[model samples]
Target: MIHGILNLPRNIWLIGLISLCNDSASEMLYPVIPLYLSSVLMAGPRALGIIEGIAEATASLLKLFSGVIMDRTRTAKPWIILGYSLAGFGRPLIALAGSWGWLLLIRFADRVGKGLRTSPRDALLASCAAPNQRGLAFGLHRAMDNAGAVIGPLLAFALLSREVPLAHIFLWAIVPALICLALSLKIRESAPAASAPKRVAFDWRLGDMPLVFKRYLVVVALFTLGNSSNMFLLLRAKEVGMPSEYVPLLWAAVSAVAMIFSIPLSALSDRVGRITVLVCGYTAYAIFYFGISATEKNTGALFLLFGLYGLFMGATEGVEKALVVDLVAEDRRGTAFGWFNLTTGLFLLPASVLFGFLYQGISPTCAFLFSGCCAIAAALLLIFFVANRRP
Candidate 1:
């Protein structure tokens, strides 16, 4: 199995494996975190929103700068190594968080690591694959990462079923992270990137990028406003009658679907058109959120909706990124991905905060309906405004 995975060019599959292990460590704590904050630490949805919101927003702000630095250095491996190590080290520290306030700092630190790595890592992925097959490469990456997500939650479920404490589960996350760090030590930069002669000038201005890419960024920002934290979905699972003991498994199920579907669907985008898949994904989100709003009593329906949500993720996550790769120049790939991450991550603060408030104040149904409408609007705009250029 290891040989089969390693048979690919070392530059590509190695990062995918590293991401798999890293995500295994990170996600081991992901599903149970809301439970930890709500039950043990005595917090609310709004508090969880604040933690996720602040952590992501801070990471995004850092990403904008990190991309510029990465393009100047022309070496992704060192920054990638440091970023992965920081996040690996950060997750284990959550066991020591006495309050959500402390957890906020820890989450912020973890996401700082993500910020440091994401743009460079994405640029690396773009470099490794053929232009025509980028969707396949990125799809494979997302699949591996989602595979780890499946593993992590299943591990959490097994531990919790065996009556292990949540804090101990957090501590156990360190093991996979250590393995990930060891693997990352071997991630070499491709020869050209390692030996590049000139530095790419840093610029974040709109005029510096492609016209279509700029318009696409506008569409992306619009979509991100409605795409809030997954914490809400986990909370809704319990509200709809899924037992806390089964929540990890519920999370695992969704990830499993994404893992299964990511490769095939993303490859499909390489053929028909990325925009088609993206529109489909946004439409799926609208339906899933609408379904979630109505699924107050049926655990079965809630599980199905979460699975559909995962399908939406599988369809869009990699394909949309491959589209980004298609739209931007190779030299400025880091900046492109940086802006992509920024647009997605920056707006998430208000999205999550507003979702929390609406769920708490107006009603869960009202909040979900609002989000569904946003998804529909984004999909329509994507179809009409952003032209998919197949090359």
Candidate 2:
């Protein structure tokens, strides 16, 4: 397995390591933030939804423009480096947050960094990968990323067990984040001659793209409408009597499962076809959400379902990325990734707000039920509209 992964280019490995570090820092902060917002900062669930939704929405909007920047410059490294620097440095500012508003500002900055970097980073990865090995390369990257999540939460758990203050832990995230930044700076861009021909101006119209790509984006938007913040899942676990201290462990468990499954499942996509794996992934997500919705305060069931949720993530995350490369021209890769992320991000805010409303207005079960139904609908659309056309 190690030898298979090592067959990819050196830059791919470097980017993977960079992702490992970056995700480590992000995950270390993630499991703690909701609790901090609600418990320590005295915010409510709606506030939590608003903050997360807006942060992600900010990233999405930037992604729409960032793609054009990448396409015009025909370079990804500089943008990538700057984005990582901002995200890494900006996130620790949460330690100084005096109120939920302050936390919102910090999250917005971090997500802005994400918005700037994500498309370029993905374009960089695709550029580095061989056509035949794109699936394996992306899968390996996601696996490394998930591995970092596993380590991050365990470290958080260990620190909290030692009674370390949460603010101190938040500050410590800078260590890995900065390390990722340094590693990111080391990635050498392929020569410009290898890139798509320079277009005179940026064209933002979806009509110019392949019909298959547009259809895929529509399916993605539909799916994202149901996919809210994972924080809600963590909150659900807490509501079911999982202790606060063990929250990191629960996160670690989910990441561990993803780490274990991401690479192999992604490789399976390379063999079987990306659409098949994606359809299965969507099915898994629906089942997981429905299961969670139906189970009432059962910690054991929640743990199992969270692991299943991880499986859902493992199957789709990298595979979907690789699929986009297959759908567009090489020169348009950055733009394609940008649009994909934008559509997903566009729906993210309303999706999260809707989930929060359903949870507050009716019940958590209703939110999950709504999401499950949407996932099922999106899966069918993928089968008819996108998958059938491609495969």
Task: Specify the highest-TM-score model's number.
Answer: 2
Task: TM-score for candidate 2, please give it.
Answer: 0.97
**For each candidate, what is the lDDT?**
0.86, 0.88
Off by over 4 Å in 2: 194-200
**What value does the lDDT take at residue 29 in candidate 1?**
90
lDDT of 1 by residue, 178-257 (tens): 89788888888755645564664666575678888888888888888888999898888887788888998999998899
Residue-by-residue lDDT tens digits, candidate 2, 46-130: 8888898999999998887787678777788887888888999988889899899999999999999999988988888898888
Candidate 2 whole-model C-alpha lDDT, 0 to 1: 0.88
Clash count, predicted structure 2: 0
TM-score of each: 0.95, 0.97
- Counting clashing residue pairs in each candidate, in order, gives 0, 0
